[model samples]
Target: MVTSGRTRAVKLDSIAAGAVDLAREAAEETAGVLGVGEYLGAYAEAERVVSHHFACPHPGYRGWHWSVTLVRASRARVATVDEVVLLPGDDALTAQEWVPWADRVEPGDVGPGMLMPSPDNDPRLEPGYTGGESAADPEPAEASVIRAVVSELGLGRERVLTVEGRDEAAERWLAGPGGPDNQLSKAAPATCITCGFFVRLRGGLGREFGVCANAYSPSDAQVVSIDHGCGAHSSVPEPERAKELPPPVWDTIAWDETGGLFD
Candidate 1:
């Protein structure tokens, strides 16, 4: 036996010498009780109590081990088995490490009753507006004065209507189906700007977008760009209805007999 800093350490050799045979016999008895195959041998170790290792017999469970622990009573000469457990050996099959439920979430897995809270420091949105006190507000007193004057003159906020915004909107319109690139617009005789059914909007946007009032047009009642066109332009003439030709005058009667009668 070996002695450590504060407590006595039971020597592994001594435990193996004493418990190995006992553990093998116990393992045999357990195998019989469990209706399993016999264990090969008992391998002993000295912990607080002595533990014995035995190889498992089940063919499906490779590299798994069965362990039986033995503890000594205060005055006892021999150690008695504390418990038996099935444990995993170094090469035994086992489940993966457990993961948190939140970490396992995937896209589209959120359903009703699932509430995902946004992070406090979201990058997409700005903090609430605090008038001039907001750090995001522009500096320059002249700039603020110009904005105020524009608002007083009935011009909307820069966010609502800006030259840059108008340019972007114009680009989008020019690239969309309502633009001159469309097949209908390509064949149209005139653009929407000159169409009688085109009702212009109010504000700066009015210069570009207008409502199509032609009931028979594909874009009827829809907002179209000023340059947009369609086959149903108001200036296009209606097709003339075909007139019925006069029935052929059949000179039925005796035109030939009349020649002889007149003679």
Candidate 2:
């Protein structure tokens, strides 16, 4: 009813304007006396039409308003009731607007057997032959040869990760549990790259990332940044081991037997 901001207020129709009693009657008929409380105000929607608002006194609908729209024909002196409805006020508690299931899903929300299909034009992926491999046209001899080799090895996928996708993955791994920032990495004696248990990955990410092969490490079998580390690093000192030694023998009696020079 109360207009503010950049909303241009429309003039109240003469006949439909002051029909407070008529609006109240409509609201009472739709929602009863308990539903229609004190009158709020009138809203001029457009020419020859207006809406009356009333405090909603219904039990379940808190902070709602009863709206009764009235309209008058041209040159008509009387207003006719148009419709009655309940609308939420600014502070009303209402359910959130519905969203599609696809839009509502988050990471890890898709369990086993649930499919989340990616669009064909998704920016994260592109044809393997034309993606990270090379952008050269197949018409060129070298490019055609490369494509053939790629297909023969079953490496020519329908789609491969785009540069943006690779970047996103790198960022996620760098900020994950196997990154250099965690408490375990901070306390590690040596980094993954310096350990013999670290297996370097292939391709562009290989230079700064790899999989941790150390079973004792927290990052076992997981992708880790080069600088990420753990206490189980291969370079850590080994535990002390038992040493072999000759048995000792008594010498006092033997010395007396061998030192008798006078005898």
Scored by TM-score, the top model is 2
lDDT of 1 by residue, 3-67 (tens): 66796655554543467677766666776543334554544455436777778777666777767
Clashing residue pairs, backbone N/CA/C < 3 A, model 1: none
lDDT of every predicted structure (CA atoms): 0.70, 0.86
Q: What is the TM-score of each candidate against the true structure?
A: 0.36, 0.73
Mind giving the per-residue lDDT tens digits that candidate 2 earns over 1-263? 98767966688986787888999989999996556899999998888899999998777888999999999998888999999999999889999999998689887798989889988898889876532445247566777877777766557677888999899989999999978999989999989989999999988888889998888877899999999999999988999999886555855444443657686
Q: Which stretches of candidate 1 lie over 4 Å from their true place?
A: 1-159, 251-263
Worst window of 10 by summed lDDT in candidate 2: 129-138
The local lDDT score (0 to 100) that residue 42 gets in candidate 2 is 90
Off by over 4 Å in 2: 1-11, 32-34, 97-103, 130-154, 241-263
